[model samples]
Target: MYRLSGVVKRYRRGRATIDALAGVDLTIEDGDQLVIKGPTGGGKSTLLQMLGGLDRPTSGTVELDGTDLARLSEAKLTRVRAATVGFVFQNFNLIPTLNAQENVEAALVPLGTRAAERRRRAAEALESVGLAERRAHLPSELSGGQQQRVAIARALVKQPKVLLADEPTGNLDENMRDEIVGLLEKMWREHGLTYVVVTHDTAIARRASRVATIRKGHVKVAEN
Candidate 1:
């Protein structure tokens, strides 16, 4: 579903330039569950942004489903992002003011979904994530695990083919982390979704179909 070749992403840090990704070459097949493990300052998150079309590579190609993202217009890229990808963040990124259902429905707004359909899809998404009963609850009223579930529902409510999760379990306890991992695996199986997860959690990496460790803007399989 994704192919990247000699991709480089550099940033101008005042007088110095920093290379976040240096000639990254990667391929992710449909239904591949990939975990990217790397130390701080490595390019794991930047790689995810490239794969999900959230950021353009400074040079080389990032192609998704045969289309080159680097060549797309910003409006075109926004359309592709809304249509093909879902994102889950470590911080949960939910609206504290909105209830769980509302938060999920907000993801559909960009797609211009009808209000009735949005509500229905949001409800179903929450149910799929096992948070249907908590739909009316505010973020502050829920546990950490429940809040993450709400975030997952929001991501999936778009029915994206690829899920880009950035440390989805980072804020949870061990048990909660396990729960989230199980939920992600189950979702991957049930939905035939491709997962690209950036995580420092070794347990999460172990559960992935493949693991790549990034260091100093390069990536390598941990094993030969």
Candidate 2:
């Protein structure tokens, strides 16, 4: 579902040129659970951005479901991301004011789904994340793990083909981390969703079908 061929991403730091990704060649198949592990500043987040159509590569190609993201117009890439991809962050990027249900429904607003249908789907999504009863709670009222669950619900409410998670377990305790990983595994199986998770946790990496480590600016497969 994802293919990156000789992908290079370079940026300027003052006058110095820095390469975030240097010739990264990687592929993520449909329904794959791929874990990307690396030290800080190794370009794992940049790679996820490339996969999600959030950033364009400086060179080479990033193809998602046969569509080359680098070749798309910004408007077209936005549409692709809205229609095909979902993202979860380590920080649980939920709005403080919006309740859990509203947060999930917000994702459907861009797709022009009817209000009633959006509500229904949002309820179902919350249920999937085991947050059905807490749908009315605000982010401030929830624990860190609960807030993360709300974020996951919001991400999955779109029914995206692929989910890009950047250090989803970074802000949680070990037990909460295990819970989140198990929840992701359940969702992947139920939705047949493709997952590319960028994390430094070895336990999370072990849960994936494939593991790749990024160092400096290169990608190395730990094992398949």
Candidate 3:
């Protein structure tokens, strides 16, 4: 569902030009659980951002479901991201002012779904993430794990074709990490949610059907 061909990204830092991704050629098929592992300063997060349509490549092409993301207009890309992609961040990016239910509903606004339908889908998504009872709670009112689950629910509410998770378990404890991974696995298998998880955790990488190690802006290894 994702294809990156000769992808290049560079940033100017003082007199030096840093390449975030240097000719990255990668493909991720539909319904695959792929884990990306790398050290700090590697291009894992950069690649994720490109795939999420949050950033454009300096050169080359990024295609999502046959649509070349690099060629899309800003407005069109925004719609594509809202309708086809979901993102989970290391720090749960939930709105502090909005309750869990409202946070999920925010994603549906772009779809122009009716208020009643939005609430219903939001509640169902929260329930899927095991946060049904906490729908009315604010971010501060919930524990760290619950907050992350809310973020997951917000992402999943779109029923996105692909889910991009960057350091998804970075802020959670071991038990909570395990719980979150378990939930992800369940979603991947049950709903066929395609996932590209950016993580440094070997255990998380091992859980994926395929694992790719990025180093110095290149893919060093891919193990199936």
Candidate 4:
């Protein structure tokens, strides 16, 4: 479902150039659950951004379902991203002004879904994350886990084929982390969604079918 061939991303820092990703080559099949483990600034997030069409590669090829991302215009890429990827972040980037259901409904804007259908799907997504009762609550009214669940609901509302999660369990306590991880795995199985999760937490890393360790802009599979 996703492929990256010799993908590279470089950034200028002061007078030096830093390579975030150095010729990354990866393929993720449909329904695969993959984890990327790395220290801070190891390019795991950069790779996720590339996969989600949030950032363009400096030079190299990134393809989603066979369409080359490097060749796409920004508008075209945005459309592709809307249809293909869902993102869950550690910060749970929900709009403070909007309640849970409205936050999830925002994801449907690009898809041209009707308001009624959007609300219905948002409700269902929240239910999947065990947040159905909290739908009308604002982000500040909820616990950390509940806010994160709402973020997950927003991501899932679109029913994206690929779920790109960045440090998904970072802010929660151990019990909350476990709860979120369980819900994520359940959603993956029930929805047949492909996932690439970036995390520093060992427990979260253990849940993935495959784990790749990244360091110094390079990645390798860690032997069990």
lDDT of 2 at 69: 99
Tens digit per residue, CA lDDT, model 4, 1-224: 88888898999999999999998888888998999999999999998898888999899899988999889999999988887789999999999999999999999999999999998999998888888899999999999999999988888889889999998989999999999989888889988999889999998888788998888788787534
Per-residue lDDT of candidate 3, residues 60-148 (tens digit): 99999888899999999999999989889999998999999999999999978899999999999999998899999999999989998
Q: Model 3 segments beyond 4 Å from truth?
A: none
Q: Which has the better TM-score: candidate 3, or candidate 4?
A: 3
Assess the local accuracy of residue 96 in candidate 3 as a C-alpha lDDT between 0 and 100: 95
**Which window of 10 residues has the lowest lDDT sum in candidate 3?**
215-224
lDDT string, candidate 1, 113-160, tens digits: 999999999999999999889999999999999999999999899999
User: Taking the tens digit of each residue's C-alpha lDDT, what string does model 2 give over 50-92?
Assistant: 9999999999999987889999999999888887898999999
Better of 1 and 3 by TM-score: 3
Report the C-alpha displacement of residue 159, candidate 4, in angstroms: 1.1
Error of 2 at 19 (Å): 0.5
TM-score of 1: 0.97
Cα-lDDT of candidate 4: 0.90
Q: Give the TM-score of candidate 4.
A: 0.97
Off by over 4 Å in 1: 222-224
* Superposed model 4: Cα runs more than 4 Å off: 222-224
